[model samples]
Target: MTKKTPSLISSEFFEPAKASEQVAPKETALEIVARLEKSLVGRNPANQQSPRPPTRVQIPLWSEDHRPVLHDLVRSALFTCGQRDARMDLKAKPIYALEHIKITYTGEELRQRDYDVYLQILHLSRGATVDNRQEWVEFEARSLIKMLGWTQNSRSLVELRETIRRLTACALEVTRSRTKSSVPVVYGGPLLLKYAGAQEGGFDEVTFWKVQINSEVAAQLKPGDYTRIDWQIRTKLSPLEKWLHAFYSTNQHPYPMKVETIHKLCGSRMAEIKFFRRAIKAALDRLTEVGFLSSWQLDDTDKVKVVRSQMLTIQDRESNNDVRT
Candidate 1:
């Protein structure tokens, strides 16, 4: 026996529309076609309202001489301390933190030096917009190297160029680890939108090379949201020391953090936690030497305690040493 295929209108259903009950079958078909045509026309790229151009994202010119580091960047390990090859995972990785200073990163491993390079780029772009569209900043890379107090020789120039390339290619996202707070800003952007330079000149030509900051990043640059650090002091710091400075700069009232958490915070690649402790000790000492920290020590609880230069150092006399690495 042959089987019948199922249909939208079953044979077992009620009677069809009578002559008087006719729903104007041909007109109904026409109406359906018209409705479908309307829908397809509505979806057609040309028929719908032209998409509004992306609104001009113009941030005010930041006129400070000090380097403006965003809290989003300063508090997290988006830029790592160690020279280890940090993974290129596109998924956001949770950065270890205390209280609610949680941050997550999504990008290639950014080094400590990348932070400096990016900040310098930000510095250059500070004068770029209030009405600027391109957001391009011009500089001869040799001068930029010297501005950062880096050597201005040929080799160093090439290294700086490569650094710019790396930063331009890499993107990152920094968001609060928790949403309990009223903070609404979450930053996500590449270090640069794009850059133009000659391989031979290394941005040292008469037509100087230029770099553009992504508008998304620049839109967040405003007063009261960024920390201004002394560029001279930053230039003197090592990779790990630089990371330490930024961390402390963001925390006005410093609290003792676990050595292990800090290890994860800076994205340290030290195979052993003990090695990170030693490096951290040396880094804190450097910070003290540079006057960013008045003093820092590990307590018996294995948490790092730090006193800033402005804060009075309350020396703890009862150090029965449990945090010594």
Candidate 2:
């Protein structure tokens, strides 16, 4: 039996690195705000706009001691925390909290637009709470929001707002948890310290900063706990999803592979083949939307005749070489 290679590529492949380079590194939140303010003034020069205070949300997190840690002044900035002995690739985790998460233009027209965008930055950091699963769990967004008794909403707008609030709270709780879960400078799982000195410092005071983990402490987590870390949206591959992705990644040879041939190659039944056919068709539709693939509908006759010509070529090559006598 041949082993199948993993087909799921990293999400980084979907994002254009060139687009990131176009953005400036030194641009400040204040500068962006100024530009927006100027544009608003330019559009509405009549000086009839009413002054409304900037909108903000205050989310609360529960510390290990059952005390509420409050981020009194949340702004458009980034925050991060990490395990003391985390692997290089998985060390630092960051969260970006947006200042003007929503825009409410309340005068002649009542329109609200969500502008909240925050990203959690994960990295290796030295902290009292470094490498402690219990502490980290206490700081995760889902768990923290649950602790805060926030209600979940199904609408995208409400979900985005709720997500931002919980994430901000998670950052504070995670950072504080790091201060509480102290692992020793010597790497050991069980002997790892649970509480680091409150005075120990490395995290940045303002937003958009990084924290460091100690060299000695290893993360005290079960293998299963690795899946629960606070990261971006990741989906568990269902069996069908796996097969569809795998088939595309390996068969770089242009399509028109016969459905029967694919079934034989995968050793699948008619029902399974039908499933893959539909899956591939849907995937192709999505790829077309993202400019990755081009496709067209074929008539019944064309569909029945489509075959892998490469397979036919190989069969002919193996069968015989044309001889001119």
Candidate 3:
């Protein structure tokens, strides 16, 4: 036999394969897909976009127990003096007179609208600290409308401007009687100063305003001098009801007052006492219905005794059923 080198091929390849022998299987498509999915377990999709965050709406938190001190005077019709029409050189006689004190409105007699503006100004500027007599207090037009529960519209804007004009033009005079002599105090400067610049589009608008509360008037507003009127209830009340609410709120412990006394204090224009009594009774009823009064009664002595409720301090939203006209 010839001496040949051993063949590189295995003996098994040269021999016939057994029927039970098997070779390793190739990976299927499903197996490949599952392996790829497992690799991507902790990762975010490359094409996904994140959502934008929501914007917050700003709602002002108004004080429930604080209003302007001027509310005491303006709440009543005394400032208006029951004058509906504007007068030239209108000077009202002393509308209210108490022991050693007298109050008079000069220039144009204020109307209910004028007092409304004055009250809003006082309410907005309640937090201001007067460093000097000439210090100016500023407020925004948008804030004024929102606080007064007015719609922001063209007509409302015009009316707001007109209100500012009236308030700045009106003057208040107070005369005090002393043991030996009487002193006369006057507030003659403009109550407010308005500033509105032209927009880029050449449109004129009243963006905001500045006001100076008279020093004498500001003195009366020191701590413990202001009243808390329920503005939510106030906006819905008629003129008479609003006045009664303001008047009674200022008195911490109200005493029984005669109807005649209330009528005089209210400075009502009604000619007859009987008519005034009826109107006043209606207003009181409204107040009671709104939970402002525990009870009120006219005694045999013709005196009106009012039992005030602590609702303003206790309740946040009073019933408005009686306030609706």
Candidate 4:
């Protein structure tokens, strides 16, 4: 019982081309070779065109004096208050505020990275052609990743998204003192109005994101008060170092600040004063090593004395100091 294999085609008579049959044009060897080459390179020979050069991505440069414009509180630890992971809901009486200003962060405690994200947003916003009513800005994820000197990876993208979310979720109740009356005017708003990313895909698929700065927050970004930070040096420093740099950069002539004052300003949750002092000392040492600070030392009273580099001063903006660390 041998089984027969089924035939794929029916037996039929095939006719050769007749003399009257339309003859097809034959391609020359060169034409055939050219077509083959085109096909191999993923081009249609029929519609072949000259190849274009790779596009040059223009990255905006950081102006020597261009600083991130941030509200004093935002620049400080009011929003990033407490431990890196602690959820905070703080009410504090700032010197400028007539009444206690409430600050809250329910999710992961806002950290130095979150503040960096905010500053980066401001940096990007400054470059954009913004109108008076322009409350929102759209940025390509790739552009931001490149600007921040971050590795193009899923983890970085996820962290970026989370940082934006934290900014949008955090809220502040700012109290402004009125000259005419003793009444305190309270202004409350989220750091960001909205944040949106690609819905149906991964980080690679998400091309851009849109973020809206809250009106109140936007108002505080006026030119005169903004401090221009050296982001190149900033990105290289530790969290505490970066914060101290920002804090001191705002002042024209930085005075000797107490470690306790700095600890409070940094919103550190270190339970022991000794630990906080050590952290501050380490940060200052790094700053000094980086040339951002000329020199720094602790006095007998435990107050930290810091000498600002000419680069950190607006008076001598042209001075180029070596920031090695």
Judged by lDDT relative to the true structure, which candidate is superior, 2 or 4?
A: 4
Tens digits of lDDT, candidate 2, 1-325? 9998876998767777786476557869999998988888888867556776433222222223221101211111121111122212212333222221211111111001111122121221212343222333113333332333334322432443333333322311122111235542212111112222111122211112122221122232212111111111011223222222223322223344454443433323335656756754554454444333344343453231211122223322232211110
Flag clash pairs in model 1.
102-177
**lDDT of candidate model 3 versus the reference:** 0.59
Each model's backbone clash number: 1, 28, 0, 1
lDDT of 4 by residue, 1-325 (tens): 9999976766432556676785689999999998988787675564565776433222233574355634345334653334355565444333221122233333445667777777777666664533324546789877787777778877778778877887887666655432446686455566677877764367434657888766555554443435567777887787788778876666545667667767766778788999988888888889988878888889988778778884444432432221110
Candidate ranking under TM-score, highest first, comes to 1, 4, 3, 2
The segments of candidate 3 whose C-alpha lies over 4 angstroms from its true place after superposition are: 1-65, 71-77, 81-89, 131-136, 175-207, 311-325
Tens-place lDDT per residue, model 3, 1-325, is: 9999999988888776676775558889999898877677537565244664332222122485345434336433455335444443557556553344456666655555556677777665655555234455677776777777778776666677767776766665655433236564333333443323222221335666776655446555533434556677777667667767776676545677777767766667677989988887888899888888888998887788888785543322221111100
Please name the candidate that would achieve the greatest lDDT relative to the true structure. 1
Which residue window of length 10 is worst by lDDT in model 1? Answer: 316-325
lDDT tens digits, residues 1-325, model 1? 9998878886645677677876753567888899998999878868776766664564544445467676666666677786656455545676654444556655566787878888887787665552225746779877787788887577777667767777777766655433475765566667787888755653433224788777776676655445566677889998888888877775555778888888877778788999888999998998888888888889998899988784321211121111111
Q: RMSD, each candidate, Å?
A: 9.6, 33.3, 23.1, 20.4
For residue 129, model 1's alpha carbon misses the true position, in angstroms, by 2.0
Query: Residue 245 error for model 3, in Å?
Result: 1.0
Q: Tell me model 4's lDDT, rounded to 2 decimals.
A: 0.63
The global C-alpha lDDT for each of the candidates, from Candidate 1 onward, is 0.69, 0.28, 0.59, 0.63
lDDT of 1 at 208: 48
Give candidate 4 misplaced runs (Cα > 4 Å).
1-65, 79-108, 127-135, 176-186, 199-205, 312-325
lDDT of 1 at 253: 57
